[model samples]
Target chain A: MSAQTLYDKLWASHVVREEADGTCLLYIDRHLVHEVTSPQAFEGLKLANRPLWRKDSVVSTADHNTPTDHWDQGIQDPISRLQVETLDANIAEFGARAYFPFKDPGQGIVHVMGPEQGATLPGMTVVCGDSHTSTHGAFGALAHGIGTSEVEHVMATQCLVAKKSKNMRVAVTGKLGDGVTAKDVALAVIGVIGTAGGTGYAIEFAGEAIAGLSVEGRMTLCNMAIEAGARSGLVAVDDKTIAYVQDRPLSPKGEAWDKAVAYWRTLVSDEGAHFDHEVVLDGAAIVPQLTWGTSPEMVVGIDGKVPDPAKEADPVKRAGMLRALEYMGLTAGTPMQEIGVDVVFIGSCTNSRIEDLREAAAVARGRKKAATVKRVLVVPGSGLVKRQAEAEGLDKVFTEAGFEWREPGCSMCLAMNADRLASGERCASTSNRNFEGRQGQGGRTHLVSPAMAAAAAVTGRFADVRTLA
Target chain B: MKAFTTLDALVCPLDRANVDTDAIIPKQFLKSIKRSGFGPNLFDEWRYLDHGEPGMDNAARPQNPDFVLNFPRYRGAEILLARENFGCGSSREHAPWALDDYGFRAVIAPSFADIFFSNSYKNGLLPIVLPAEVVDRLFAECEAKEGYRLTVDLPAQQVVTPDGTAFGFEITEHRKRCLLGGLDEIGLTLLHAADIRAFEEKRRADQPWLFA
Candidate 1:
């Protein structure tokens, strides 16, 4: 057989048919749904009088609009309440294979819940309406986010008409320094390649550095692939991936487990497979990165100073830098550590896993939050992660440091719930985007790792965690 | 879904790059289960001074004259002209919904985020990608003329200026067919139901745990 990249192999396995045009009808192995994007899709199905093609292939949860605090009281916002209610009604009517309603023990961010339950598997094709669905690609699945219309199409057909994407390889080499992490590596990659650099390509992250990361760490790396403009990012399946999925609730059992494992071992790319584009980065040179401007590309090392717009040669880029600087309320040439913060948010689909919380708890142990820091929140990605963190006493360490250990939901990341930044509040966030008013109407966000956020909570400013250690 | 064979519509120049979905329609408005009402709040933060809560009368709100959409000249524009990497954040189909509901039939940008580009075609909104220089020229022309417009001829794959200068563009034959026919994706996929069913049966036996 000819050499094939991992993505090419996965794509070929799922294709039902290739049309006269470039589109192919690819079968979906798993379709995950969330509250924010699925309502309209169900509504479309109702309008068209269509039945769900295969109910067993779909799973859902209510995450985006759920209030992290007062979970027992139910949703307070009228619109948020309606969205959750709509999902519940749709799940009942359509008969989804599984549904984790708000406040359920299994309820969490869709991306977090999928992997934790083993719904995402190696060599499978997974999709969801939320862009972070790429987080499932950590398991070597051909996963990506689809629009609501595509969501409706998947709901009705159990397949998607996908156009093949060019393959790119991002190879990170060398050992990571202390206090650096997958979030740092991801940020470093985005920093090297601008926000739009990965457009029109499916990136396979490779090399010794990628092979060394934990499954959770790999999820963090792939989760932010969308921020780099790539719809899907993949890491080849290995022993670590199989081990992580082995004992999960939905994983195979007995003789079936062995069969699945045998198939998964073949999911890796052949040694001589060709990639359309290649990027190589040195991992040791990377430090904990923080976004200074609006775009993820506008980043600098933790100890670096804000970039001067005057130094920018491109007029369009210069304008964006100026806008970000003005909106973020930072002066060019000022050290990033000098910038004070009002809130420190250390959760989201990106960095809210058990390992991420452990990193933050290590920094927060025996340290109290600074007087200038008003609010510090530690939200795990899912209820199961929350329970695991509590069992390990990471919640206690966080609460002692003045951080509120909230329920697992997309709290304050997009500010769909009551947990939001008031206008003009500056935050150190572990969430993906830092667009203007993303946290709130006029709030500012700075993206960082969980440890970095924890350090910011204690210092009330952007402090390098390396110094704290 | 509306078929897009040709449109001679006024162009609105939004001189910005990386305009994210959150800015297209803020998170507060996304709570609605319904998708159609987003247009009035499209670019809500930029277009209005006061906060836009659900059910608030859009007309009653104070409009920011400085915002591109609120300007008198570009009020009813059907085409949006923007810079590179437009729609770069969250995959809220609401971004295209808000754009479509706000009376826009098409968007022209130097480049577009992948998911947003796909969503636009599915929702009957044409996202045309042109070179940065061509986009810059269009922006200049729209700014210079009070009522500048472009005649988009989809069948010919050309955008013609008022002076008769034409710029050619390219799109996949599949997307072209869908846009021209206004074909619903779900309906299109249902036509291949037998193939989908056969594929699922094979998958069920291969990975029984996945179905469970």
Candidate 2:
């Protein structure tokens, strides 16, 4: 047998059939669902009179439409309320392996909850209707996002009709500088590759820097793969992967655990494997990164200045930068640190794990939010994450620093709920995207890491976390 | 699913690269359970001056005069001409649902993000990928001429311009067949139910932990 990449091995093992045109009916082992993308899919199943193939393969939760604040008050917006109710009705009608309702202890963003519950395992193919489904690929699973129609297809057939993506390796070597976290590495990668760089390929993060990252850090890296235009991002499984999956609620028990571990050990790429594309980055040179424009590719170090469109050679790109600067209320040559922010968001599927919260809390331990900063929101990824943070006194650390400790949901990430930015309000966010009107209509979002967001919260501007005492 | 054959219609040129899904259909409107009614809210932020919510009367909203979608000449245009990496962010099928509802039969672009491209096919919206230079030429031609239209022949795999210039595009045989037939992918895949079951059975025997 020829040496195979990790993607190749996963694709081959899951092939139920291959059509003449080279499309494969790939078997799906896990399907994670959230409120925003599932309603239409459930309706599709009902319209077609199709039954779910394997209820045991599905794990669902309501996150997007659930308000991160005021759980006791219930969802204030009627439309948001209906969406969450619709998911609950669908899950009740079609049973799943697990269904975490809005206030369920296990409830969280589907991407965060899936791996946290051990439902997302190594050497398996995972999917969700949300684009951030790539987050589960950090577990060495072949995970990617699907459309609502494909969600129905997966529901009815427990399989996906997929075309295999080409293999691309992004190897980051050398040591990361102080305060240069996984979010910085992800931003730096996007900066090098541009937004559409990995369009048709599955990127595998490798080399010494990738190996040194913790499991949560690996997840943060893979979470932004979608921002780089890749459907999936992966990392080969190792001891850290094994340890993370060992005692989770849904993990295999007793004899099955040993067998699963043995099989997962083989999930790595074979030596001498071929790759269609490869990129190398020096991690030591990467500083804390932030987005200066609407696109993730429009990123620079925290010390860098806003890019001048006059220096741009491409007219389209220059126009885009100009539009972004206007939308973000930024000037061409202004230093990034000089920019002030009205709000700071520290939550999303990208960062909101216990580690992310701890990182933010470390910076915000005793510091007070600047008077000019209107609000600082610290939303946990899951109810479990919230509970864990509270246990570690991380919630107190945030609240003591004048931050609002909120419940678990994708708060202010897409801002489908009431937690959103006002018109023209500038926010330092730990979320994934910086697109125009993403946080809210006319709201400006600057993408940064959890610590960066905390630092911005304390100083009311983009502050360098490394320079702190 | 409506079968897509050929579309000869006026072109609306959207001269922007990386037009993300959020720009196509904003998140606020995604609360709907049904796929219809999204067309009115398509490019809501860019198309209108005020912020758009789900139940707001789009008819009363002040339209952005500069937006191409609002231009009198581009009204009722069924073909959208766009630049590179159109539909670049988020996996919301609402983007295509909105495009289809807005009466766009086909979108010709330099490139498309993978997920949006796949979702477009499922909703009967044909996404045609042309070279960047060819797309540039189309944009220039569409802007220069009023009521400029193009004919997309899916069966022939060519996009024909008003001046009789035809540019070829690629589509897989399986996708082409499905699109032409207005076929349901779930039904098509279920034809091989036995194959799927066999594969599952083999996996269960080999890696029993997955089933557990």
Off by over 4 Å in 1: none
Residue-level lDDT tens digits of model 1 in A1-469 = 7999999999998898788877999999899989889999999999999998888778899999999888778888988899999999999999877889998999999999999988888988999999888898899999989999889999888888889999989999988889999999999999998889888888889888899999999999999999999999999999999999998877888988898999999998899998999999998888999999888899999989999999999999999999999999889999999999999998999999999999999999999999999999899999999999999999999999889999999999999999899989999999999999899988999999999999999999999999998
Interface RMSD of 2: 0.7
- Against the correct fold, how does model 2 do in TM-score? 0.99
Best by DockQ: 2
Docking class of 2: high
Off by over 4 Å in 2: none
In the order shown, the candidates' Cα RMSDs to the true structure are: 1.0, 0.7
Best lDDT among the predictions, by candidate number = 2
Clashing residue pairs for model 1:
none
lDDT, residue B145, candidate 1: 98
